[model samples]
Structure formats: structure tokens, C-alpha cells
Target: MNWPQSFIKPKYLSLTYLLSLFLTLFFLSCEINYDGDERLLVTGRILNENNLPIPNQDVEFWIYKGSGAGGDDDLISLTATDNNGQFLMLIPSPNNEDGFELKISDPDTIYQHKILHRILDKNFTNYEYNIGDIVLYQHHVITNAYITFNKTTVNTSLMDVKFKGDADYLVWINEPETYYGDYEPTLAHDYYKNVPLNSTLTITYTIRDNSTETLSTHEATVTINNENLEYIINY
Candidate 1:
């Protein structure tokens, strides 16, 4: 008598599961890396509050537990970022996976940790997915930090500014329309979060001098401490 093709014996399934467990442990012990274009490749960049790369930080990938059928939350792989604060996770996509999570953490109390939840729209699109940029805020806080851009020349056309992270009325990438020249403290665009404390914010702005009819490029830096420190930009 022969069994059905799709029918898996309970004992056989247990053995296969055990074997996979052994393999996962062995691979992790040897090298926290897996390679191949066919595998599911997840990548991201890790940065500090000041928008600086964080190297050698711990990163992990976990698959959620499937309902009634699959096992518990499966930790597929573990790895760390390179000198450039970049990480790559290559693993075989499991069967019937609802979603997954990418966890970034530090064992040493240097930087605060983060967990990113990703839900698949039916399934993944490409072999590679990039999570653009991630900022891990270090342990600290700035009670009152602000920025004031003063117009040096009269009749200035427009002003634009950028920061290493979010602010009251500023987004790291683009300027919010509601924020004319003042920020009330909020968040937006490209991984928005509360202002990072005790960090140096780099500001690059383009101010058009109407009288000169030329664009001026300027750079400035301001360090935020316990007091009300303002990043004054004279454009």
C-alpha cells in the first residue's frame, strides 16, 4: 500500500523540522551570512541620531507564526552592519509566511534599538528590497532645541534647509509648506521621528539673493545640549 503524495507522516515532519533546526544553528555558528540571488535578500542602512553610519550593530530577521499550522516566530537569520552601516540578509523564504520583521539592536547600551515590521502584498516583488535609511537615536534628550535662519540680504527670493533628522517643523529631506521659517516640533518625510538630542545637526541651504540675482550655497552646524541652543544660519 502506498500513501498519498501530499500526505506527510507526523514522525517524518518532526524529523524534518529537527533537521532544519540543526542546520540553522550550524550556519549561524560558522558565518552569519548566506548568499545567492535566488534567495530573499533584505537590505538597509543604519545611522545614528546625527545621521552617521553605525557599524557592527546587531540585526535580525524573524518570520511571524502562521495560524494553526506553522510553528512559532521563526528567527531566520542574524547579522551585523558593515563599516558603511549597511546590512544584507539572505535567506530562503519560508512557506506560508504572513509577514516578517527586521530587528536592529545593540547589546552594548550605545544606541537605542528599533524593530521594523514589513507586510507582504501577497508576496515579495524583487529579490532585493531596500529600506532606504534608518536612524537609531542615542540615549539622551534636548529639552529646547531650535533653528533660526536669518536673512542677511534684503529681498531674499526663497530659503531651503535640510537636517540630519526630523525637527519641530522640519523634515530631513524636504521643507514642509506649513513651516515658513519657524518650526513648532513635529515630524515628516523619509523616516520621521522626534528631534535627536545632544547631536550636531548639519544644515545646507540655498538662498537666492534677489539683488545679486545669484544663488548662494552655505553650510552650518549647531550642537544641541541641555539649554535652548538655536542653529542660527545667516544666509
Candidate 2:
């Protein structure tokens, strides 16, 4: 008198349909990153250049405003490393923010603050994300070395002055070459570079004499320290 269970499939088909719907929604959510409720459990360890754990190191999570935002970065969360130099953060992924930055500050202020940025596309679906280990270095005390290029002759010549030093070595042209009215690189590219304490720099100048149509090279080496801050090169 009753319809067979196989023939009456509405109840069974509805259950299957609901299950499929749930799975589809779950995957769809994962595909769309930066969901409102999405969050990350971040973990990392802080160490010094000497391979020693840095305890009490500040850890700040920030939602970096992309270029042209014209606003300050939004702070997400702030914490510090434990005694063992380990840190963990439960931070949210904002739907509006396009980038994230982690600021690791040294509590003692000896080391320069580290900025970790350019992290945007990540698996927000994952329960945890580990940033691994970070190393901090103490701020290097730098001494500025001023340079002056003295031309030996008023005749026009091709002079190329080059310098080699650490990354901090910089050449800042505060005054344009028009100040000296010379087209030579010695006057045009003449600038000072910051030399860290106990750092050395090599200064080389290549001169192309227009009168003789020949080239001459000269080299000089100098070390910068607390006692020796001035490095003057003459051409």
C-alpha cells in the first residue's frame, strides 16, 4: 500500500543537496580572502645577530595603508616576545586593508626597529601562519665624511671620481654642479657619504687629460672612527 523507499527519493535527494551546498559555501569563502571574520594565528621568534634570544621585544601588527592612502597605518595588535624570544599573535584580516606590516621594535632601543611588509596574499583559511625567525642588529653610529673637489686646472677635462664602501655609503649632492661651474664628474658627482664607526672607504679618481689625450688614475684609502671623522679627498 506504501510507495517504495527508493521510488520516494525527495527526502534522500534533499539531504544530499544540503550537504553539497554547505561544502560549496565553505570553499567559496576560502577562495575569497580577507573575509570579515577571517583571522590568523601568527607565530615567530626574535633573535639578535649573536644568535641570542631577545626577550621583551615589541611585536606590533599593523594594517598598512597602500600607496596614496595619505593616512597613518592602522594598528591591529601589539604584543611582546616572551622570555624565550617567542611571540604569537591572534590578529584579524580586515576586508578593507590591502596590506599588512609587522613592526618588531627593540624594547631596549639598542637595535633599530624592523619593519616587515609586502605581505598581502596569503592563505587566510589556514588556522596558523608562522613568520619564522627574525634577527636584529644594533644601530651603527655613523660619521659623515665631507668631500671637496679641487680642480688643478681651469681647462676642461673629463674627471670621474668613484667611491666604494658599505651600504651606508651615500653621495648627496646638496649643491648642484652649477655651483662650481664645472662639467666634470669630480665636481658634479662630488658628495659626502656616511661612514660607520670603524669603517673604511676607498676613493679612486680617473682623469682623462684633454691636452695629452691620456688617462691617469689615483687611489687613496682611509678609515673612519670616533677619533678620525674627517675624510678629505683631493684631485
The 0-to-1 C-alpha lDDT of every candidate, in the order given, reads 0.62, 0.64
Model 1: how far residue 62 lies from native, Å: 0.5
- lDDT against true structure, model 2: 0.64
Candidate with the greatest lDDT versus the true structure:
2
Taking the tens digit of each residue's C-alpha lDDT, what string does model 1 give over 171-222?
Answer: 1222323554332122211212345566566766666766677877777776
**Which pairs clash in model 1?**
168-185, 168-186
How many residue pairs clash in all the candidates, one count each?
2, 0
Model 1 off-target regions past 4 Å?
Answer: 1-38, 66-71, 121-123, 142-195, 198-235
Q: Go through the candidates in order and give the C-alpha RMSD of each one to the true structure.
A: 14.3, 15.5
